[model samples]
Target chain A: MHTSGSRIVRVGTSLAVPVRRRALVQGLAVVAALVAVGIATLTLGGLGIAPERLPAALIDIPGGSEGFVLKRLRGPRFVVAVATGAALGISGALFQTVTRNPLGSPDVIGLTAGAGAGAAAASLLLPGAVSVPAGAMLGAAGATVVVFVSTGRGFSSPSRLIIAGIGVSAMAVAFTQYVVMLQSRDQAAVLHAYLTGSLSARSWQNAAVIGGALAVLLPAAIALGRRLHLIEMGDELADALGGKAEQTRVWSIVVAIALSAAAVSVAGPIAFVSLTAPQITKRLSRTPGANVVLSALTGAFILAAADLCAQQVPVVEDLPVGVLTAGIGGLYLGYLLVREWKKGTV
Target chain B: MLVGSVLLLGAAVLAGLALGSNPIPLPEVIAALSGGGDAYTRTVVESRIPRTLQGLLVGACLALSGVLVQGITRNPLGDPGLLGVNIGASASVVTATAFFGLGGHATIWAALPGAFLAVGVVSLIGSGRGGATPVRLVLAGAVVSAVLSAYIQAMTLSLPDVFGSYRYWVVGSLAGGDTDTLLGVLPFAVAGLVLAVLMAAPLNALALGDTTAATLGANTTAIRIGGMLSATLLCAAATASAGPIAFIGLAVPHIVRALVGNDHRWQVPLGLVLGPVLLLTADVLGRVIARPQEIMVGVVTAFVGAPALLLAVRRMRAGT
Candidate 1:
């Protein structure tokens, strides 16, 4: 029952390897699960590629039927899913840690809605005035700023943040819908599809954009991982322990916003992956602190699995992945709210 | 204050009739109302009249329900739409159209049951053995709304025919309301309003806290159930009549509460009058802004209502 502080397994000190060993094993298991799901996503689609040839097909560079499916269709989609999921997972972990609330996620805080509004404005209002990703990033930043300023106490009060986020979210969504309605019918349909968060027709370009973002942001989040854990001990205590609490909070939020905006730009606002992933990972790892890596893995797994389900589910084929996540996540969110209410923390 | 609210409501109703894609003179509107106008004037006035009436009814219903819900939950932010009633009605209507093959007037039937079922589930989950607190009710409502919204998205995506009509309806407009529809929904709205008025006194008693209210001879549980039922009924009728117009239910009560003190007796009636005023004003504004192509009232209300919500949140935080 080592509940004195955040569970710390000091490497090279040789204090206890069991806790560290457990984390390592859990990480490996999650990785294995991710790989299995990724493989399933690749091979289980309409393309009837044999399982034995999957490894070879994945590696084959030139031009073959299997290579075309692996590289062209499934490969990019798989990469985008993993990248976006990991981004959301990491961002969710950072935000939850900062807000000290399990419900604190990018989507919950209106970042995704802001990104959607930005994308809508760029595509509809500006019309090639700027790139979609840049627009989304701007929107995400704007939403974060609004939430921050509106909260008055910054990240200290979780409930105030959520309420402010909800208000901002409503406004952003209204603006997006208004912009959508202003466009031509076909264009409006395109915007609507994007808003629903589909992986269909995703390109290697999308994959590269998200992958590039994760490349920079993931490492940055991991580096702040220790500070994030410390800050979870309360700001004064973390400051006493030599952690730059405010600096860490700001940096974590910036990284989280960047990751979220990048994902939204590529995949639209994929609902609840950022939210459910971290909580699931925390429960699975049974750890006292933010499990950034494990959360990323869980996010990747959930999004990939959800994408797979969206593609393959009978009668629900080609349904936007966001719908599935929102449907499942909504129920989970309700349950969490009830639990939190019972505990008198909500 | 009540007289002022009634006057505002009257002005809003007049504005709704007088302003549209095709504006009518006030005299012409009056003439049409008195059943003696030219054919073109009659056609235009007749078309606008039902929508205006529908707006008034729906707005009043939503506003009154908002007061009851806020009173029962004891949460200033409590709104029928926020409490999952709107989304539930929407999801039900969408499902009815998409799967059950029901359409047009038949959708209202679906909406009523759906709205009630959703509120029922929210109450059951939100209310533990003790009772549903404001926080739990809100969280429950949000969760239900999210799930139902997803269901709506899925249905609309799968069924394009449904989507074509559902999209406009979901955004909420008074354009679709005809005299027949208006007349049909009127009974339910009136019934719900009556129920709300009847419960207002008990609601005031309940505001003193459950133990005190009980000691004061108010049946707290009965009041809660009665209030919830009335609110749900009102929300369903309004949503069915004109889609899910956002913000009015949430915002109007706050406005009314601000103008009139927090007496349920005063708040309920004032909210009833002022709710239509806000809704009709937003609807008329929506018409004026977009011109030939009117924006839906729901969108307009969001634009108007969200700022009010932010203010409400700020005030709530400050008070606490």
Candidate 2:
């Protein structure tokens, strides 16, 4: 997974269990579930709007009572959650599948820290959202490179890759804290929210940026995802089957990195998306070979649920969508940990 | 081995006692250390003495805790940092700080129970029917830690006023605190240490793997429970006094392993002694490097310990 150029294994098409029709049906159901609930949440409110007026709020056929709240507040937030979850889920699945390690999520490997560094550099050291995203991309790449380099000799070992990732993540964390310390206390306050992975005060502009990214990357992931499935089988077999292991792996990483960076830019390193989403999706669906699409759908559904709860769930007001996800994800994390322990020889 | 580690521990304590941002003469540092002059005495007593003692106590607590955990889980990498112990403690402290206007030493007391609760929750979930595996223990720890960290994030953002001072404090400092806290939590720390050292016999047996340890006539359940409780106490006391520091727990055991081999008998004691030695040294170095402004010990240790981990892991692979 941490090979110098690419750690892509050759996935043989002969072994490729074609996407079954039943799984497709199930996936569509999941996606439809996400959309239905998302819309429901977007419309439902405590603003004294009658439940019957919800349909009007959707079409804007009203005298601007409930329409303003739905369209102005919840609409943008819903779009943000869906897009963020999609990006994180897809990125997470790709990260785990490519690394062939369950724990190989963006946060665990220092990608968020990198993105934090990138964002901080843009806000403080550098300037512009363009610079922030660019810096995030750079930070993600830098962390990946460091992890890869540290574990280069044992490139095929999942354990080494993760351990190396831990080191890089630690370093990135220290760098981030140092940067935060250097900034004016005011800027530090702003960055603190971003660091916690909140989607508060998000407007259409933020939604548009991430939604536009989904517009580009989602299709690419679909088109390229099949080839990614091939890369998972092992490099030698993949090469024998007329695939360039290096190229496939590189593109898979590119797709994964792009998606992860998109999520980081939007949600400020809401980590477990990539790690948890793919695992949860695969486990639930029991359909293997990189459940990228399902993971994305699951990510969207989870985030939408979390975001809606964040808005209305009286448990704690203004709890970030990320916070709920982490709390829920923590449970899943425990399950996975136990499972990993069960599998371990030690 | 014992004498060497003890000598090293002594040297570390003396260095810690001597060094600080305040430039006291080494001799006067010794004199002040030995309870000598008046104003110089107060300076040493107030700043240097407490800081060094805290570093020493905190280091030992962290090391002993790490060894306890690593022994129980049988994972080389198991530490408070990796398992989210620090994050749990910090989160608990943050919650207390936010909820109650509990300031100063009260935060430490608040932190202790929270730290124990976090550890207890993770252990229960991870233990299941099959007992604790290295992977499960870590995963459970990470999950709990990650969850609490989110709460910490919310606390930081929502309570910006409370979080302001805490941001620096959370980074793990060894200065400008009430030294009476050192004496306050010292009993728990000492008791935890004593219990942890006593468990060396069972932990040593368990080191041979769980079934065999059972075969060796050790009460597996009792040993594990006692060990975990002690480790939690150690971590809670340290976190209460100094905030949650990483690397010492995570990397100290790994470094100790390299020094000798995987014998709990030696590793535990060496880790107990050396953990503080490393932390004290790191604390002292933090003082000397930044001049008047001190680098937080947490940052210093990660910077130092991570490389040690990398080198150690690299060596492990090569040795294997």
Candidate 3:
């Protein structure tokens, strides 16, 4: 039978769950868009390959230029883009659900900037090549500790956390700029692109890194989603219901930090994807609570489409995907702010 | 308090003159100022004058803009740098430099309109159904700043020539200051300062909430417009002349407000004095701290101001 908001789905006698019909449709649509974008990414670039030859490219990975471009280049870049986007999306959903605030994403809370700063220090300052991902993870964890400690009341106070995050973000950005200034002009240009979160020249290694992170973290995020939703209701209710809000919040934050750090390490700190994805997905799905699956799909679609658009922009070669997302996502944030104000929700 | 700030200003000006990569002695600095030192020593000291003067003018403008913006918005977090004015100015300057080949003194012309447009956008988004809240305005400003910076990066990265000039400017330093640039931006800074002084009482009146201020015979609309206009002019001049220095505007008014009550008269003057004191001191430190290589004033201010910002955030009440 139909319920007010969600329909109860029955599978045999053991398990039944209520699912929102619109969320299911939107989720499928996002996945379809993602597939189309993936196909387009594979077909179009500096050197174009026809859509019909994509299957051939995959088969002849050791032989033709088309295969080299596809298997070695576009394929890995596309995979990293989707994986990191998905990672950012689920990370954002977890943070938003845990904080019970739409603005509570990795970027907003200084984690992304911290990761950027850490990566910058590793790349620019370390004598030889250092592990950029490890640096990013440490930076994200450091920001979390600072924000958590500075709040005094922990993450329960959303505004306080957000304010502390702004401070931390500012400091990290300054440090990043300082590091950038230390390099030669040519090196600085390259670092600048990387810092802005480019997907260009992404290797299979980068793809594997993000892919593995998503595989491990995404499932954990989804399983934790139910508890996070209950946590959003209130601490007392959640604890009374055996959800243990405090423990869930702490675990969710750790998972979120790892997901964002892995994405940042692979592609650098892409701006606003983590902030806008969950918000966009929630609005599209017309559902409450953390929809990690839907958000991840939306993020993958958004990043894939942005990277495709970035590649296609004429006269502006080597445009970073982060720049496009920053501009578009910022506009979205502005719109969200006005809408929330009008709705008296902010 | 005024006397104390003036004394601090004097000390900072001395530091600006005395400390540098060259490390002139205090006596040599005083002698160089009197035009009695050796030629090379005199040259170095003379070279420092433009930057010191630029620092004073830019710092005063930024601090005054901070007070006006905070007063008008009634938001403690209000600052020219935080509110996207500086980045907006950078965006316009970069666009002018890249597309129109405007360089040196001409970039100031591009900055004013951009700063004004940013102020307009921030107000439009920040103030609405229930008027502006501190968090809403800050978030709106951050969003605008991020977008503008993305545009700036896009322009800079695409053209190597633009990147060369932009990298230095974007770091927010007084290192590139010269007499011509100082002269170019001086009039706007003066105009803005005078306007800020003229708007003080009206701003104070409007602080009692718009309805109450309007009922008390204050022109809320005029006060609002005048305040933002003054802030925009000051911010543009400072950013155009010295690049986009952060924390001076945010920190100066805050420290000033803590010393003086909520009175705009006291805050405005003290901010004018303290702003330069902070900037010149930062410049001096940037010079001496790194030995042969110099850190930018922008980086130094961020280092100093970030902790202040965090402290402020920690001490913030439950809700504004």
Candidate 4:
């Protein structure tokens, strides 16, 4: 989806600047990229629109195309795509950094799997929380707790953490499938979209849920992410520098969970953005901070762009946005694997 | 261990045969198996045995494929299904069914060719000088899988009747028509198993990384081609027999690795044994728990594998 052959985004560079400044620059650049892409998404939709009138249409300046199409249709979808992309991308980055494994992200870390499990249970078994975000959160919390409990000794090594995450995520997948099988065949399609990830038939109501969740969660990640900066310096060093190793980890994880849950609830577990965005941001920033803000902006840009591409092929009526991203996510994962292979390192 | 696994498999197969929307007893099952019972015996023999065989073959294939793939990639963790073998097979079947208007045995035939094509495309795109480098293979597979899966989704949505009917098969299952599928694909399964076994020696050598393996007189090219051929054959045969059953590749190999460590020779065999054991057990549990309404085996396996994967990740973190 990213046309990797022609243009590989220049991310990793050893720019000579203070780590903090580098991150700020990267954040601004990614924001600029996202803004352009977001507008492009609004321009390219089901119905045709005149680019000259794009600004007028956006502001609803007296009969520019259709009011409902601009405000209600494309506007909400663009918002959801941007929000979901950013949330998933940063979430992936956070998990990868904390785990220290490139493969470690919300999807691989069991966050999405756990949330999917919860969503499936709500829809199939309970049905009360079928459309409720809280049910998904509850499920994610349970899975995260289980994941954290298993890693109680310490969360220093990235590889080990990912291995543990796989185990937890596998169970969630199984449980979700089990529930789907028990339900009538008619219900399986809806259940499957949650597991595989999708953003079809999204509306203002859906956007509100996602937007509302993001409002609470993104700020928390930003605040707690500062503490994570210290923790990443190594556990012993962090403790020596007056950081409470255990409490800080707990808080970061809580933040990670909030971000992951909100992302899953809104976007239905878009893949690898969370895992790849932060790494890309870090490379662009050349910093130790892991650039959460840059990750969010970059993620938003990626999703909005992908969403634009998806809308082009109206063959499926509603192309799954996650499917589009997963395509790229898989490629990015492969790229990491290739790098690891080439270096003879994992 | 083999005996225990076989017993568990037998018990699971019997339970699957006996338990369904309609229930039958132990005696009735015996009579049915011996060809002296009522319509139930014929049904069990014709339906259950083939279904069980499909499970057995696919499970063994997946477990073995997982071992082969992990060996080739040199990653303790690699999923053949994740590598898009299943996606390839599924996309092929969907094309045949929804687009080409194929069904029944014809659909199965279409699936085999489709599976082969998918495997061919993925391998061709993924393989390189380093003997199918793990990352390239993964990325290539990811692309192929996504493209094929997108086609599937598009087709399914368009052809509501075919796609709607294909729902059971899509999610992965072993409860559908068994006899024709079993008979049609048994040769492929047997051939695949033999091919996998044959790959043991070169794969063992390949485990020492490509350079050392080459230094040790291993034919890198032959080993890679053989390993890939076997993996594709196993997956294609298994998918043709049952629809693409998910996660056996991921879970069985992980369990086998835990039991036998990283030796492909030992790991492959262990995976073969344990894969059947796990699938059968899951099948049995599905039968018993759901009872009059049996849960699909694929769904059950996901339930079992997902948490186990999570647990493994958590433990690794703790150790780190």
TM-score for each predicted model, relative to the true structure = 0.82, 0.82, 0.83, 0.80
B-chain TM-score, candidate 4: 0.88
- The list of candidate 4 runs beyond 4 A from truth reads A1-30, A43-71, A126-137, A149-254, A275-291, A310-317, A327-346, B1-47, B219-222, B304-320
lDDT of 1 by residue, A265-317 (tens): 88888887887788777655667667778888888877887788887779678
lDDT tens digits by residue: candidate 2, A1-346: 2323223344675443345554577689888889777767765556535666666656764556566556566677788888999898887776677666555676766678777766666677665545655676677777777766676544344456556666666766766676677667788887666666777766788788788888888877765567666666777777887666667655665676677777776667675666677877876666556677888898888788777777776766676677778877777766765565566532
**What fraction of the real A-B contacts shows up in model 3?**
0.59
For candidate 3, give the lDDT of residue A121. Answer: 79
Cα lDDT tens digits, model 4, B1-320, are 55666676677667756765566787788788777877745675556666666677778887888788777766544777656778887877777777677777776787787777777776766665455666566656655666676567656554666655567576667777467777888788788889888888788888787789889998887887788788878877877777766677877777766666767777767778777767766776676786677777777777676566555554442334
Q: Among all windows of ten consecutive residues in candidate 3 chain B, which has the lowest summed lDDT?
A: B128-137
- Tell me the spans in candidate 3 whose CA falls farther than 4 Å from its real position: A1-3, A8-18, A45-70, A94-104, A131-160, A219-249, A282-291, A331-346, B1-6, B22-47, B67-78, B121-143, B194-226, B252-270, B311-320
lDDT of 4 by residue, A1-346 (tens): 1222223334458432223445566677778877877667666655646678777766664454566656666777888888887777667666656655445567666787788788887887667635635567678877877776676554444565565666677677767756665667667666655555666557887788777777887877776566677777777888898766667665555566677777777767666567557755655555565466777887887788777767775643366766667566546645654555566542
Q: Between prediction 1 and prediction 2, which has the larger DockQ? A: 2
Candidate 3 lDDT, A235-261, residue by residue in tens = 899899998877887788778888988
Better of 1 and 3 by TM-score: 3
True contacts kept of 2: 0.40
Query: Which candidate wins on DockQ?
Result: 3
Tell me the lDDT of candidate 3.
0.82
Query: What is candidate 3's lDDT per residue for B105-180, written digit by digit as tens?
Result: 7877888788878877887787767566555666778778878988987987888888877777778889888998
Q: Compute the lDDT for candidate 2.
A: 0.73
Candidate 2: Cα lDDT at A26? 64
What is candidate 1's local distance difference test score?
A: 0.80
- Across B1-320, the per-residue lDDT of candidate 1 in tens digits comes to 89887888888888898898889999988998898888888888777878888888998998999899989888755789767898899888988888778888887788888998999988877776666766567667767877888888887776777777676677778878888888777788888999999998899898899889889898887898899999998988999888887668877777777777678999988988888888899899999987898888888887787667666656654523
Pairs that clash in candidate 2: A9-A234, A9-A235, A10-A234, A10-A235, A10-A238, A11-A230, A92-A274
Clashing pairs in 3: none
